[model samples]
Target: MESPASNSPRMRLDHLRKEGSGETHSRVFELEPCDHDNWSNPRFGSMNALEILRETVRILRYNSSGFMAIAALLICPVSAVLLSNVLVDLSLVKRLTIRLLLVSKSSGLPLRPFIKQSCQKFAEMAISSATCFPLFITLSLLSKAAIVYTVDCSYSRKKFDTSKFYGIICKIWWRLVSTYLWVCMVIVGCITFFFLVLAAVCNSFAIIGFSPNLVVYAAMTVGLVFSVVFANAIIICNIAIVISVLEDVSGPEALLRSGALIKGQTHVGLLMYLGSTIGMAFVEGLFEHRVTTLSYGDGSSRVWEGPLLVIMYSFIVLIDSMMSAVFYYSCRYSTMESSDGEECQSILESVVVSPQAMDVQ
Candidate 1:
């Protein structure tokens, strides 16, 4: 069979003119729609969630940067959580000690000394928490930048250079950070809007007497809206980040380009994000359960659980970042193909129905 290219506009026009019939020209125009079957073929079709995940794993498997990327991504969040937990424990201990000191007047301990000690400890913990917050944010952003560069390089089979890669990140770090904040605010706004709408409706209909069924329905409604909005926001942000990394664009331009890229292909992005997220959660849950079972009835298991969870989480972050990169490339490929197909069709129409061709007819 002749390929689509062999039947280009020039060839088709020559063939139709040779036939020298108006009916033939019109019939050819009506019959030969764009070759969308080729577009729909598996080779050309959009990548499915599994295919995206496979590509992600394939890149990670072949690339040496995968582990480093995972470490970079996980360090900040894990450290922050650990720090916060430690601070909480310290605060609680301080409170307990102060309470005990107050209750024991006969211990010959001055209240001022104990109170001052407790306050000092409290201030130290507060300062630690405050410092950890900014460090967490900075580390998280740096890690994200590293992961993005790593995944892009891995997929493109480019060598990863630490200094060069970070240099690129440092250049646009603020722009990426700003874009991230904007996307977060939009997602939060959507979820908040739905919650507020539900609340307002409930208040306005107070006379109707809210029942158990109504409460359940309202909860479900809020959940559905929130889920849809969150999924969309995630997909969009993922695309925007990819754009920012690759195209060197920033802020709203990155976002606009992302929106344009995923115009009719939102489902692919949505599925990619949702599938990876759910799969990671399920695997993490299984791992946690196994850890618990192994450590069942063991006092020393607590020590192992934290480290094991961190390792599992790091792996999850690596896979998640890789999958997102694959999805971005796939979506960008689809967008380009669609645009090319449209351009081809337009050129074909202009050639086939040209004034000269109609005159010849």
Candidate 2:
């Protein structure tokens, strides 16, 4: 005696029960709610710097074994070489330092008291970096690829698969290398431009009869501005590397995409960069003091202290790379939420439903 309209709900349930298997019923019902939740909850974006750090820690905890393996196999040797400066040619560095000094003296520019030591250190670093270029292009880039892949797997709630990551890396290696080369060029260009501008300002002041003190103040001002610009460039380049690996972009295209992605997240990126820089500097200082300069009891401490510091440095590198990946996700999520909300929701729903749809078939 019930009205047809009142019976419609029960009839639809009965129809579903008859038409769909138990597994399909559960899959459809359970997955639909989860998909809605995922679409509503979008937890990946709009995180502050501290939140990003927290997320990185969470990710590390989730896949500590995989990340640690990556650090040991790929990052540790690079860290050791860089920290110890083992491959740097001292004689070549000394020659380069002398040449730089001679050029500066001939140019009649005023040299500060610390200029000689700074020049020497700079030459050594440049030599070391150049000598290690192959390693950076190969192992360092590979490590970054592995880290990014692992992070993606973690977010997707999947275990790290070595074979899968290797396949992904094989596909993305050239793109990553291209992006890295562009990043290097951009950084070198920034440094060159900074020096050029500083030199021009100093030369102009000299020609105009400015006081030495004023010139020093002017140089300091320029340095401050350069530092800010350089930091931004580094952040952009780091993000660009992530973009290149995650997307089908590389080089200038990847850099452009990164710039767009980080529109609302610059502060977060800067703070992350600052923290990583401080950690690295602290570890390097400890290495220099404990292992290199303050060796005790016939320098036996170096045997353990050196490797330990290298491991610590490698850990910092791993963390920095992980942060970069997390930051990319944050920025991308925010961008999608802001500009393509409906699209994002649809994509999430589709992703959740596709497997169930296949299972039903």
The candidate that wins on lDDT is 2
- lDDT comparing candidate 2 with the true structure: 0.73
Best by TM-score: 2
Query: Which regions of candidate 1 are displaced past 4 Å?
Result: 1-45, 69-136, 279-298, 341-361
For every model shown, the clashing-pair count is: 0, 0
lDDT of 2 at 187: 91
Q: What are the per-residue Cα lDDT tens digits for candidate 2 across 65-115?
A: 889999999999899989998888889999999987775444334677665
What are the clashing pairs of model 1? none
Alpha-carbon runs more than 4 Å astray in model 2: 1-45, 102-109, 342-361
RMSD of 2: 11.8
TM-score of each prediction: 0.62, 0.82
Model 1, 125-145: lDDT tens digits are 444555555544476556666
